[model samples]
Target: MRFLAGLFALLAAFFPGAAPAQVVDGAVPGRAAAASVTDPENILVLDLSTGGRVRIWLRPDVAPKMVERVKTLARQRFYDGLAFHRVIDGFMAQGGDPKGDGTGGSPLPDLPAEFNYLPHVRGAVSAARAEAENSANSQFFIVFQPRFALDKKYTVFGRVIDGMQYVDAIERGEPPASPSRILRAYVLADNPPPYVAQPSLPLPAPASTLLPLPTGPAAATPKSAPSPKPVRRAARKATRR
Candidate 1:
């Protein structure tokens, strides 16, 4: 376990502009220490449809507005039953869209970019946005492999501190024929309700029903990238919009 931890530390050391807040001494890789969460309010807990709970340590220090947006949505139970609409093997799982299609976001206004020094290492949670840097709303994704190319290009508001195995278990596809989902999301400080298995919602509306894509110099049709390698390669490209 220490070997795995040391490898992550080394990766951080070699990666330019990696955030220092999460690289703690004696930290285990994949399974971050639960005690690392000093403030429960900063912990975002997801009870996944895949079964088991995943805890992400929200980093307001680097991406305050993005974190606030996430917390606000969770408090509203806005994420309950949302499908992991886009999951790429060895890449990331993208979700939090109300329309269950990549083009949708919450009714809330879009937020300006809060890009920071946080590296897109495994377990990193970043906001999904349109080409316009300020277009991120309720959509976000969790990194399953280190994606250095994504660093500073996306707003990383949190990192999975535990239950990554469950994240790893998320079904893989642009839209998995049997996609996994978030049963519920909560701010740990609020003592949200426990997980209970719920019947799946009808499959997401077909692509033909997708909302109009955002329009601007930054806008592009949202599409899931192809599968990527485990390390040091420019993984498949996706708009994450």
Candidate 2:
């Protein structure tokens, strides 16, 4: 017991980012710790074929249509056992194409453009496309820093709700010498108890965000002042007489 405790302590101390499993199993020193992943969808696990597993929390509200597309592809094993062929340090780590080229796409039909004005902030999950904006299929990339160049251009749908450091730990470049891969990619909120719907009225416009209409209500004007009443003068002349 004392030896095991000492071992655990050493692993936790030296391998600060190493998960407990990695600690015991002799993983890299500065890798990310593993944790149980739970999202509103379902428990989606991302096991790296090279080593270790991670949890992903997908956002459906942000890109409902895209999320549905990804889930559909995952169900059909579109990304099963696929490799993270392209990995760039201090920039982004991309994958999900079966062809293993930065260029391959899914067998399914192409997706329509869902570009929004959202920023390409760090940890942002966005669709990978070709020359066309509406060409996003199954390939995607996770940004590690603000990619302003991608803003207003790419379709940003999700983010790294958890397990980002693990992604950073992966080896870089196509066919990484270490061969990092996502053993599986699954949905989290496949089927949950649906939210109860209650009738609600439209929200009032916020003054700050309200855009002045080209022609709405007329500009308010001050009302005309009523005519001043005539001042009555004292009638003391009769008294004087």
Candidate 3:
């Protein structure tokens, strides 16, 4: 093992910009100098029904085919309304199963695993597949914590850059009592409105306690100073006091 480590270190020293080999089950090859998505335009935004949003910047360099698949699916609005069917706190939040039962995917064919050296660190977005190595499809999962065991096992195509707090707050359950959903999804490159999840207004207090809507012009009219009472000439009475 020491010899192998030394060999890897030597290779890295020879190759500029090479990622250091991570010592997992064994010394795995490091990330190569490949083009990655360094712009915000390659991001995917998930507007959740829970009023939370997560932004993930896609890494085309690590998994080009998978990233393209994700972009195509997002453009088709394929992920909208999908429930996080399988969520394990401290692990990951899995979704994109159209069936919402962890047993479905896009009608399109499955993806061959694009496993790379990308580590499954917090907020890593990876493809979820069946028992088969090449069964990955539309379904994917977002890591909430570092999971080195999953490194190179799943296709790591993206990572959460903003709104990871929301991902961390995802309901924890294999199938949450009420699964949160992707209310809508779109590519950031499309220049979509930035998602800002705000707390729902307190149900308008209770209709009974709420003020009634003003009627007609009364609602539209702006208030003004009352007219002066014509300087009520103190009734010049008092017989010219």
Best by lDDT: 1
Residue pairs in steric clash, candidate 3? none
What range of 10 consecutive residues in model 1 has the weakest lDDT sum?
231-240
* Model 2 misplaced stretches (Cα beyond 4 Å): 1-39, 42-44, 189-241
TM-score of 2: 0.58
- Residue 30's lDDT within candidate 3 is 61
Ranking by lDDT: 1, 3, 2
Q: Which stretches of candidate 1 lie over 4 Å from their true place?
A: 1-36, 206-241
- Please, what are the lDDT tens digits per residue for candidate 2 over residues 1-241? 9998898899889998663544545333554322223544634445555445455555554455666777787767677666665565655667766656444666666677677655777788777665445566777777766666666666777767667776777667534655466766666555423222222222111101000111212221211223222211111110000
RMSD in Å for all candidates? 10.7, 26.6, 25.3
Instruction: Report the error of model 2 at residue 163, Å.
Output: 1.2
Shift in Å, residue 99, candidate 2: 0.5
Winner on lDDT between 1 and 3 is 1
lDDT of each: 0.74, 0.55, 0.66
